[model samples]
Target: MANAGQKNRLVAVHLDESIGRGPPDIEHERAVAIFDLIDENSFAPVGKEEGPYKLNLAIAERRLIFDIRKEDDTEVMTHILSLSPFRKIVKDYFVICESYYDAIKSGSPRRIEAIDMGRRGVHDEGSRLLQERLQGKIEVDFDTARRLFTLVCVLHWRG
Candidate 1:
């Protein structure tokens, strides 16, 4: 393992605030890129045979369990940068985040974002904001050293 101060990586996936949005309308190609980045360690997909191989991002050898279980037909991804290695290795990584309410199942704009603090500390406000912003949206917070970013995934369906 690297030293305590080694820099890590953060790969976020979600809506782009730049895109004029109800939620991030992530394209299929971009989606692939987001997933590819998280899989940088090449851990291999789990839960594939029985269901969509899934799990929150793994870090420091353990998995960061999702605040909520991911629903089918839902996806959230965004890119984050300048995060610390410790937090990058543990907090922000993800395999899946269930978005039932606004899930893509029905086809609506949903947003997913990951922030790299590149440091360490616990966050709760953003999580609460997500809960308030989108009914039951999922949020992931990472604490590396001081650098950190919040991953927000919002699911809303539209016809």
Candidate 2:
């Protein structure tokens, strides 16, 4: 059952196609993250009450853009955040993910597990940073933040 707070969740999410798709694994991750995020999340732009919003995330002019709208496509607000704070974390995440993928190919179970743990740790760090950055603008739970961070990483994908 959903509480009243859950009413503020996101009903739709879209990534700008112009951003260019990543490799197969990256695409899969992006799809899964979008599915999980829409399935369950708590998202409310600060000082706003009505919701079940729609979000279109994009990276333009080196800025991370959050295009928030009402369910009916009415524009609510757009937030453009600097990407500088996330550069290091995003780079670190990609490095760890590469190691994790390689480990899954032939490495021992123990090695794979260790790499996965490190990946999750880096993911959590990114999630926390996202929450901090959106502190005064948007309110999101940790899980939502994590999922959003995943989408943010997808937007940063160059391959």
Candidate 3:
């Protein structure tokens, strides 16, 4: 059972083939984000529908594709979002993440904490942007938005 506004939650999350394989860290993040999301999330597509949804994430023709389905695997919706708006933030997020990871190895605790704070800021911005973009199509909470944003960034990987 879910709250009134959240009758649909994601029961399954899949990444598309075209997104390509990622490095171990990226793969780990993807796996963990999806796991955390499915374990607890509230995603309800706008309309008179009830679901535990299945989501397939991919990128095609310079657009981010969300192939959404129902619990029984019936198609629900396919929402395509432009990636242009996210390019800068995603790039910044990657740079900050790299810095943070490196800081853990060599930088002082203060330096590591500073870099981590920046990293979290960028992640939060990405999540906010995602929620704004998803305004009419889907509804998700901040934590869900954050996890979904991680998957989006993972999909943005070129190699």
Candidate 4:
């Protein structure tokens, strides 16, 4: 658990699903598809992009990256990205996982940078509430909320 001011959440996306495996042909078709679904999901974007992404319940931007790791001799490609600066009067502040893309574009893998907050206008009320409720239960802030992408990657395991 993070203190009141400092908290770091790590969401891991590792599974034995078909997508988890590196197919003979690597492409971001699924990722692109998800990106295209974002607008309808309610996410506008901390910055801007071309797509139909599945944004979270809050209004934020959708970023993307591939989470690469090794397990049992198989290299897994998990999409990692985040939405930020979400404000919910009821929830106050919360982040959402926009999408996960496999690192398979041929050539070489790349790193995904974080979204720009200058335009995000992020604020967390629910996080504050939880902070007040616990008085130190968990540290929620820009970084914490920004961690939505990690959560999104591992969310499938919650079930």
Per-residue lDDT over 1-159 for candidate 3, one digit per residue giving the tens place of the 0 to 100 score: 233345578888999876578887788889999989988787878883888789998888878898899878899888999989999999999889878888888999999999999999999999999999998888888999999999998998876
Q: How accurate is candidate 1 locally (lDDT)?
A: 0.27
Model 4: worst 10 consecutive residues (lDDT sum): 92-101
Runs off by more than 4 Å, candidate 4: 1-122, 146-159
Residue 11 accuracy (lDDT) in model 3: 83
Q: Estimate each model's TM-score.
A: 0.18, 0.96, 0.93, 0.19
**What lDDT tens digits, residue by residue, belong to model 2 across residues 111-154?**
99999999999999999999999999999999999999999999
Q: Residue 134 of candidate 3: its Cα lDDT?
A: 91
User: Lowest-lDDT window of 10 residues in candidate 1?
Assistant: 150-159
Candidate 1 Cα misplacement greater than 4 A, ranges: 1-24, 28-37, 40-53, 56-139, 142-154
For candidate 4, write residues 11-128 as lDDT tens digits: 2222234324232222242243233322112221222232222222211134333343322323333333342321232222122212112212222332212221211332234333
Model 3 ranges off by over 4 Å: 1-6
TM-score comparison, 1 vs 2, better candidate: 2
Model 2 ranges with Cα > 4 A deviation: 1-5
| Per-candidate local distance difference test | 0.27, 0.93, 0.87, 0.28
